[model samples]
Target: MLRKKKITFVINYFYPDLAATSQLMTELTGYLQKDFTITVIAAQPGYAGENHQSKKLFEEGYVETIKVVRIKLPEVNKNSKVSRLKYISSYFFLANIALLKEKGTDVIFTISQPPVLGGLIGTIGKLLKRSKHVYSIHDFNPEQAQAVAYTNNQSVFKIAKIIDKLNCSYADQVLVVGEDMAETLRGRFEDETVPNYTVISNWTDEDAIVPIEKSEPAIRGFLETHGLKDKFIVMYSGNLGLYYDLENLIQVADKFREQPDIVFLFIGEGAVKERIQRYAAEKNLENVKFLPYQPKEFLKYSLNSADVHLVVNQKGIKGVSVPSKIYGVMAAGKPVLGVLEQGSEVQRLIFESGAGVVIEPQNYEGVIHAIHYLHSLDPGELKSMGLKGRAYLEENLTRATSINKYRQVLQAVADNSPLEHTFQPKQYKEVVHKK
Candidate 1:
C-alpha cells in the first residue's frame, strides 16, 4: 500500500478565520485529510478589517484536530504597500521556521498571495529539505495590484511583477483557480516543464449547504420588519477589498437612490470595508444595507434570499484571476450582475449560463446601465434566470468536480505527469524589482 502523502497545506488564512479564502482553505484541507497527512500553515487568528480573532490556540495547532499552524501576520491593508509588503514578509520569516523545520514534508502546497512569499520560501524549503513545491495562485497579484492602482509607480510595480513571476516560475507545480488564470501564466512563462501548471476552480460546499427553504415566518418576518419585503434583493456577500471597486458600486447605489424596489445588501468585511460603509452612510444610499461576514453554511441562506445576485470587479485585472466568490454566487443560482471586463471569464460565464446580466466597469455609466436594465425586467424573468444559474451550478460547479480536478492534477504531478503545449510568451516582460 502507498504510504499516505505528507502534504503541507499552506495559506494566509484558515478555519476559525472568517475570510472566504480562509474558509476555502479549511474545507479543502478537511476533505483531503483522511488520504493525506496534512498540516496547514497560515497567518494567526486576527483580521484587522473585520476586528475578527481566532480565540483558541488551534487544538495543538490543529483546528478541531485538523492540523494547522497559525503564523502571526505583521500588518496588512489593500492600499498600504508597506503594510502589504510587511504582511508578505511575515510569511517569509515564519515559513522558514514553521514549514522548513518539519521533517519529511514530501510536498509544500501554498494557497495564494500572502503565501506567495511563502511559496518562494516553500520552494527554498523544497530544495533544502528534498520536497516538491506547489504554488496555488488564487489571484495574480502584481498585475492585479497595478490594475487596481495599488502600485502606480513603474518601479514598485516592476518589482511586484518580478516577485510574482519568480513565485510562479520557481515552483515545482502551479495550481490555478481557473483555466483563464492558467492560460495567463502559460502565456508568460518560459520553462513550463519545471514549473508544472493545473487548473481547479475553487468550489462551494455542495454537501454542507442544504437547499434553501423559507420555512420560518421568522425569516420573512425579519425581512418584513426591516422593510426589505416586496423588494428585489440584490446582494453582494464577501470582502470589500482591492479588487471590489466598491467606490464605483456605491456610486451605482447613488444613481438609484430612488429605486426603493431594489434592495441592495453588502454582507462582509475587508480592508476597504469601512470606507464603503462610510460612503453608504454619507450618501444616505437607502437602497444599500451592510452586514458582517457569516459562516459558509449560513451564507447559503442569504445567498438564496437574493433576487438578483451581484459581483463586481475592476477591469483589465481579471485575466490573471477569477474571483471564487463568483462561483458561490453562481452556485446559489441567482442571476449575477457581474461587473467586470466585458469579455472576461465572469462576463463569459454570465453569458454562457444565461442566468444574469453582465455590465462593464466603466464607472457610473456601466453601473447605471446594469441597474436600469435589471430593474426593467419582470420579477418572474429574473427568477427564471436564477433557476437557470442554480441548475448550471449543480451540474458543473459542484464540490466533487472541484476536488476531483485537483486530485487529478496532484496525481499527475506526483506521477511526473507529461503534457503538451505549443504556446510561448510573445511579449516577454523581464521582471525587475528593488527593496
Candidate 2:
C-alpha cells in the first residue's frame, strides 16, 4: 500500500546552498522523496559561500523537481554573535510569516546553531496548526556552543539555555548524529516523558568512493605544487573551525619542518583557518601548506591522495561532538589517525572498527608518535585498516541504511504500526521485497 505524507523538513540551509550540513540533509531527502512529500524551507544566505542578498528568495512561479520554499534572510557575518542573533531572528520572523499562508506540517526539523530560530518558528507553527514537531539536531545549541567556546560566554548564553531546553522538551522526537549527543539530551530533560529519540551516524556518498589511482588535477597539483609528490603526505582536509585546536597541531608541524617529506596540508575555511595559515607562514613552516576549499564532488579525489588521514579535536568535548570527517575518511578507505578527547564517539569508532589510532588532543608528543607509528605500518597493515573502515561504513553509514531506519520510524507514526516485533529469518536468499 502506497501512502503519501505531508512532511516538512525544516533546516537553516538547503540545496543550491552546498554547505556541508546543507548537502547532508539534501542528500538524505533524495532517497526520502520516494516515501514523503517533503517541503524544505531554508535561509537564503547559508553557513558557507552561498549568496543570499543577491539571490531570489522564493522560486515563486516555478515548480521545481522538489517543492522547496526559500525565505529571504538578511545577511549576517558568521564571525560575530550580535550579527548571528540578528540573522536568527530574521529567519524566525520570516518563517512565522510563511506559516500563516501554509500551515499543516507533520514534522519540523532543524540543524542546531543559528537555526535555533527554525526550532522556535516550528514550535509556534506546530501549536498554532495542531501538528507534530521533530528536531534534527546536528549540533547541540547554547551549552554545546559554550563547550566549543563558539559562544561569547556562559552568562551570555543563560537565557538561550532556557529557550534551547524548551526547544528540546517541546519536540515530538529528537534525531541526533551520534550517541554522545543523545546522552546530552537525556541530561537536559532527565525526565521520563522526554520525546522519542534516535542517533543517525554520519555518511559519505558510496558512489564517489572509487579507488581509481588518483588522476584528478587538484590532487596532482596539491602534491606537485608543494613538492609533496615524493613525501608520505598525512593530510587533514576540511573546515579548520574553532572546535579544533589546530594552531597547537601546527606547532608540531613547525618541529617537523626538517622532515619536509612528511607534509601537513590543511584545506578549507573557518574563523581560525586564516589564523592558522598566518601562524604557519610566520614560522616559515616548509612542511605545512594551506589550500582553499573546493566542492564535495571534487573532495573524493583530493582525499584519495592522502597516505594517512587526520582528524583532530580539542580535549574533553567528546560525545558532546562527533567529527563528521570519520565517515568520509572511512568512505575513502584510508587509515585514520584521529586526535580526539578520550571516551568519545571518535575513540569508540576507532576501537570498534580497528580502523585508526587515537592520539590525545593537545599532546604534541602523541601526535608526533602517531605520525611515526602510522608511517611505520607495513603497506599491507595500512590497507587492512582502510578495508575495515570501509567495510564498517558500508554496513552502518550508507544512505540506504539511514533511509530504512527513517522509514521504520515514519511508518510507525503514519500507520500506527508498532515497532516492537520479533524478527525471523527465512532462506539465505530471502527476499525483503518480492517482485
Candidate 3:
C-alpha cells in the first residue's frame, strides 16, 4: 500500500476552540485525514474562555486518527495590544519549534491567523523541511487592520504588509475564502507575478445545522431559557470582533429600545465585546442582551431562535474579510439583515439567493429601515425567504463540495502536478421555496 502523504497544519486554533476558524479547520482536517497523514499544531483551547493549563510547553494528543500538538501560551486579553502580542509571538515561536519535531512532512498548511505570523510559519517550514506550503488567507491583515483602524502606525502596517506579501510569494499554493478576497490578493502584486491561488468558500455543516421549526423542543427551550420566547429576535452571532463594526452596530439596539417586543441578541466574545457590553449597560439598553458562545451542538437551535440575523462588516472591509457566521445563518434558514458593502461576497450571496435585505455598511438608518421591513413580513414570507438561502447553500456551497475541493488541491500539490480541476464560483440558481 502506498503511504499517505504527511501534511502538518500550523494554526492557532483547533478541535476544541470555539472560534469559527477553529471549527472550520477542525472540520477540514477531519475530511482530509483519509487522504493525508494529518498533524495539527495549535494553542490550547481558549477561544471561548476555556481554561486549559499545561505544565509542558507542548502536549501531544489525538482527535480520532489525527495527531495534535497543543502549545501552552499565556491567556489573551484581546483589548490590549501588549497582551495580544505576547500571545501571538509565543504561538509563532512554539509552532515553529513543533513543526521541526514532526517527521517526514510533505506539506505545511497554515491560515492567516495572528496576521502574517501564521503564513510565516508555513513559509519558514517550507524552507526548513523542503516541503510544499499552502497558505489560506482567512483575513488579509494590514488592510483589514487599517479598515477598522486597529492600528494607526503606518510604519508597522507597511512592515506587516511587506512580510505577508513575502509569505504569499513563498507559498506553493494560496487559498482565499472569497472572490472579493481573491481580488485583494491580486492587488498585492499589481503589475507583477501573482502567486498561484484558488478561491475556496468556507462552509458550515449542513447536516448538523439543518433548519428546525421554532416549535422544536431544542429551539423552544433555548428561546425560553434566554428570555427570547415570542420576542422578535435580531441576532448577531459570532465573534464580537474588530472587523464587523459590531461596537458601533450595537448602537442600533438603542433605536428599538422603545419596542418592548423587539430584542437584539449579541452572542460570542472578542476584543470589543466588553466595550459594547459597557455601552449597553451605560445606555441601559434593556432590549439588547449578550450571551456567551454556545457549544457546537447547540448552534442549530440557537441559530434558529432568531427572527432575522445581522451579517455585517466595517466600511472599507469589502474584500479584507468575510464573516463566517453568514454560513451558519443560511444553514439555519434565517433571513438576513445584511450591513455589507455592495458587490462584496456575502452581499452578493444574499442578493442572489433572495435570502434577505442588505444595506451599505455604516448606514444606521438603512439598517433600521431594513429591520423594520423584514419584521413587517408575515411569518410564512420570512420562512420562505430563509428557505431560499438554505436551498442555495444545499445546491452550491455544501460541505462536501468544499471538502472535496480541498482534497483535490492538497492531492495535486502533494504530487507536484498542476491542478487538473478549475474551480469557478457557482452561479447560484434562483431558489424559491415555500414553507
Candidate 4:
C-alpha cells in the first residue's frame, strides 16, 4: 500500500482552543486527515484563558489519528504588548524546533498568525524538510495592523511587511481566505512575479451549526441564562478585537440604552475588550453586556439566541482582514447588521445572500438607523432574510466544499504538480468595481 503523504501544520491554535482560527483549523485538519497523515505544532490551549498544566517544553498528544505537539507558552495578557511579545517569540522559536523534529513531511501547512512568524515557520520547515509549503493567510499583518493604526512606527511596519513578503515568495502555494485578500497578495508584488496563490473561502461546520429555532430548549435556555430572553438581541459573537471598531460601536449601544427591550451583546475577549467594557461602564450603558467566549459545542445554541448579528471590520480592513464570525452568524440563520466596507468580501456575501442590512464602518448614525430598521421588521421577514443566508451557505459555502478544495490543493502541491482546479469568487471584483 502506498503511504499517505504527511502534512505538518505549524499554527498557534488548534482543537479545543476557542479562537475562530482554532476552530476552523481543527475542523479543517479533521477533514483533511482522511487523505493525509497529519501533524500539528501548536501552543498550549490559551485562546480563551484555558489553564495549561504541562511544564515540559513540548507535550505530545493525539486528536484521533493526528499527532499534536503543544508547546508550553507563557500566559498572554492581550492588553499588554510585553506579554504578547513573550508569547509570540516563544511560540515561534519552539514551533520551529517542533517542525524540525517531524519525520518525512511531504507538505508543511501554516496560517498567518503572530504576524510574520507563522509564515516564517512554514518557509523554514519547507527548506529543512524539502517539502512543499502551503501558506494560508488568514489576516495580512502590517497591513491589518496599519488598517487599525495599531502601531504608528513605519519602520517596524516596513520590516514586518518585507519579512512576510519574503515568506510568501518562498511558499510553494499560497491560500487566501477572501477574494479581497487575493488582491492584497497581488499588491505585495506589483510589477513582479507574484507567488502562486488561490482564493479559498473559510467555512463553519454547516452540519454541526445548523439553524435551530430560538424556542428550542438549548437555545431558549442559553438566552434565559444570559438575561437575553425575549430581548431584541444585537450580538457581536466573535473576538472583541482591535479591527472591528467596537470602541465606537459601544457608543452606538449607548444610544439604544433608552430602549429597555434592546440589548447589545458582546461574547468574546481580546486586547481592546477591557477598554470597551470600561467605556460601557463609564457611560453606564445598561443595554450592553459582555460575556466570555463560549465553548465550541455550545456555539450553535449561543448563536441561535441572537436576533441580529453584527459582522464588522475597521474601515481600512477591506482586503487586510475578513471576519470569519460572519459564517457562524449565517449558519445559525441570523440576520446580519454588517458594518463593513463597500465591496469587502463579507459585505459582498451579506449583499448576495440577502442575509441582512449593511452599513459602512464608522457610520455610527447609519448603524443606529440600520438597527432601528431591523428592529422594526416583522418577525417572519427577519426569519426569511436570515434563512436566505443559510440557503446561500448551504449551496455555495459549505464546509465540505472548502475541505474538498483544500484536499485537491494539498494533493497537487504534494505531487509538485500545477493545481488542476482554481476556485474563483463569482466575478465579485467586477461587480464591485463596476458600481
Give the candidate number with the greatest TM-score.
Answer: 3
13-118 in candidate 4: lDDT tens per residue? 9978888898889989998898999999998998887777898999999999999999998888888889989989989999999999899999999999989989
How far in Å is the alpha carbon of 132 misplaced in model 2? 0.9
lDDT of 3 by residue, 1-435 (tens): 999999999988998899999999999999899999999999999988987878999999999899999999998888899999999999999999999999999999999998999999998999999999999999999899999887789999999999999999999999888888878988999998888888888999999998999999988888888888889999999998888888788898889988888999999999889999999999999899999999999999899999999999999999989988989999999999999999798998999899999999889989988888988899999999999999999988888888887888888889998886655445622111111
What is the number of residue pairs that collide in model 3?
Answer: 0
lDDT, candidate 1, equals: 0.69
User: TM-score for all predictions?
Assistant: 0.88, 0.88, 0.97, 0.97
Mind giving the per-residue lDDT tens digits that candidate 1 earns over 1-435? 888778887677777778777777787778777767788777775563444445543323666556777766555665676887787776677767787767767778876556346566766777788887778888876677777776568887777667767877767677776556765776666454335665566778766553354444545764676677877777888877767778767767776777678888887877777788899898888888887776555677777767777787777766766766777777666778887776566676677778887777766686678777877888678777766766766776788776765655555445555433212221212211111
Task: Supply the global lDDT for candidate 4.
Answer: 0.89
| Backbone clashes, candidate 4 | 0
TM-score of 1: 0.88
Per lDDT, the best of the predicted structures is 3
Error of 4 at 434 (Å): 26
* Model 3 regions lying over 4 Å from their true place: 428-435
Q: Give the TM-score of candidate 4.
A: 0.97
Write down the RMSD of all candidates, one decimal each. 5.4, 4.9, 4.2, 2.8
Ranking by lDDT: 3, 4, 2, 1
Question: Model 3 TM-score?
Answer: 0.97
lDDT at 348, model 2:
72
